[model samples]
Target: MKWVLPSLLFSLFFFFLNCTDVDYNEKSVNRTSRKILIDASHDGGVWWSPQSGTYSASLPHQGKLMADFLRSYGFTVDELPSFSVITDSILQQYDKVIRAGCFGTYQPSELQAYVNYTNRPTSLFLIGEYLNPAQIDQLAENLGIHFQGIYYGNLDTYAPHIITDSATSFYYNAGSIIVNAGTNPAIIPLGWLDGDNNKPSLGILQHPFSKILFIGDINGIESLPQPLTLKIFKWLFG
Candidate 1:
């Protein structure tokens, strides 16, 4: 009877160790398995070269740097080609969607698809710089935000948010003005240009199951943006 009890205790000790190891492994895998989709299709001024009779990609250097930066954090980053469209199936494959420096216009169907996608449990990061004013307005309207076509510069003001610290100051070559169009409780302003507290230069909208982060300019991808960009990515991946 004494030998039997010791044998049972030995078995239980090994079993507990095995269970703890499995849980640790599972947590580690989950932490590194996060997926991010960087939509490069609309960026980089993609066009066909008639002389070469082939398509070419003029992807922004900053966008490429952003992808590399994300990969360094152990996140699986997918840079979709310009020919790719944001579809329901495509959106499902990623936990976060980043639309950066997109100048191309979206079709009505594609816009509707984005609307549907944003209404779901997803995270969208919208970065625009010198994009089509009409397209920007369209997107703002769809998101229930007001976007003025005018570009603001010399912005020395910032609202404190997850992506910025109290000492952080930001300036953009050019940026659009965005503000909440209605009294939607879900929309929250993140930052604003100096002397212009009424309009938001950066904002986040939280839906029931989804969230959207809007940046008026692509300066966040620049080297000077520094900790702001890093903090933004952390917030997104978190």
Candidate 2:
């Protein structure tokens, strides 16, 4: 958790850039009662320390800011310390879910539980890392999407969707791209890596009663433009 001057300053630049999104929290507070579960159970590092809200000012603390953003929007944010079975008792509680990382394998019933949950009107957001993505890909495969490739820097393409409106200039510390696996009617590309529509940096899977948005980047959440992040939450829980 230590930092040198130049490297610290560089990270700080993106930190403040992302922190500016904290204002979006004030923009809309107590707006709705939508509930969200940030599945940090798999040892996901995308969320904050809970103890350190957005005030920590460190780059990683930006995850805390994301939680604050949700709170400001009047959504109840919950954390899952384990990805065991994802029983209906737990899945039924939240209107939306965001899974940012996974270190271990997922239970077969858990994947089926998610599939069952999506049979209703719900939304799920997935963030992928450039490093080991076996577990992430496994879950994604069950959901009809795939994460592939590895790279760092700008995503290089965008869609006309509201989500992409605020993510025009998204640059990442590191990330991956979603592979184009045949033609799944339910899947739509939200953003691409270098103008290749087949490979996406951001994609969404449309289910009968649910939608799953996948971000092919580890730092995608923390590094996402504030406006873009705000729009995504609003669209998901709003």
Candidate 3:
């Protein structure tokens, strides 16, 4: 009986170890197989041309850089030039959606569709720049956030977040300010401009099964280090 009890204890220990290993391996596989969608449509405003009426038929460098970064971490990335291609069926295929520098007005149905998608297991990263107040307000209302269309500049530094470094001095050509709307528990601030009375430069809304990360400026991603970028991806993807 003494030997039997010792043997049973040993077996239980080994079983627990095996279960832990399986869980870790499963999480690693999920991260490796994760797919991301980068939306460069809606006048991303990441690239500019000095010559009048000259446009390049190329994806925005910001989107390309972000895609490349995510790809390096074993993530599959898809770049879309227009949100029109996104449907409920299509949105289900991606684990995350990143809309960088978006300034286009969305229809009510389109906004509702996106809201529905966020309510699922899918995550979203909304990057904005220089949008009109009305457009910002509309988006804020739809997403249960408070966004003001005001450019913040001449800033010596910024608040740190999952992606931003505390020591980094940040400046934006045109950046919006976000505040807590108090409508939902999911909506919360992630980062903010320095010395702006805690006005959020980056916000996150954690829905029931999904999440949304909002950045006031897309340029912030361009300046982030690879380590910080990876951290951001981990936060968004996980």
Candidate 4:
């Protein structure tokens, strides 16, 4: 297997970015272990993109890493195969739901199920392209959260192994994020097209959000040493 970028660096990037001198209630942030659900189901069990390759490979490699990492961070993690099967009753039991950026469309009922889940006060980590913009907007509005970026057709930033385009960068960048408008603005601004030539490329919006963490790029989580990922699991879950 070819490791395009060391997963250790990627993990660290997220950890440090979230560890600045922000006045988060250390006690509150470190409360009891939160239940975290990893959503990996896609419509038709595949992701569709104009780019190329099989849909099975479109899922984020970081999902497993993130789950294990979060587990180390004092949180309980579970890989959910089908979002449709995860009913509202099951969702309400968890504290956090990390959306692994599914690239396919959802059945009307499935979308509605997500609606019910977001209505309550549950922390959500959305990674990847926001499929079905309409449903996304509805959920965002309900949650009083807003994420910038207009989707232009389909830009697949994964195949070429370059962060210069959405088509490739999105393989890693396609995950959902925490968009805090009042406190942390959109830092590490990402788009399918670079402004000058409009060519595809990965860009970071440099605004900090929630506490001191940057939304666009998670430096610490992405760059942590392999051992550290386990350390993070312990921190978040222990």
Give TM-scores for every candidate, taking all chains together and pairing residue i with residue i: 0.72, 0.74, 0.72, 0.43
Count: clashes, candidate 2: 0
Candidate 1, residues 1-238, lDDT tens digits: the string is: 7799999999999998887653221323236438888765565432111212233234344455667666666677787666567776777677688876555567777678777777777778877655444656455567776656556564456666656664366665566667553466766776767756775677777767666887767654444365667666656655
The TM-score ranking, best first, is 2, 3, 1, 4
lDDT agreement with native, every candidate: 0.63, 0.67, 0.62, 0.41
Q: Which is better, 2 or 3, measured by TM-score?
A: 2
Ranked by lDDT, the better of candidates 3 and 4 is: 3
Which pairs of residues collide in model 3?
none
* Best candidate according to lDDT: 2
> Any runs in candidate 3 off by more than 4 Å, and if so which?
1-29, 47-60, 82-85, 137-140, 153-169, 181-185, 225-227
Candidate structures ordered by lDDT, highest first: 2, 1, 3, 4
lDDT for each residue of candidate 4 in 1-238, tens digit (9 for 90 to 100): 4564678778889999888644322323446536777665642232222222332323454334555556554566676653345566767676566554444455566566666665554445444343344545333333344444433332232222222222222222333333444353442333333232232223332312211111222222343333323322332233
lDDT of 2 by residue, 122-233 (tens): 8888776664544356677788776665677677677889777756666755676666545677778877766776667777788778867888775656654767777777
Candidate 1 clash pair list: 41-82
lDDT of 3 at 124: 82
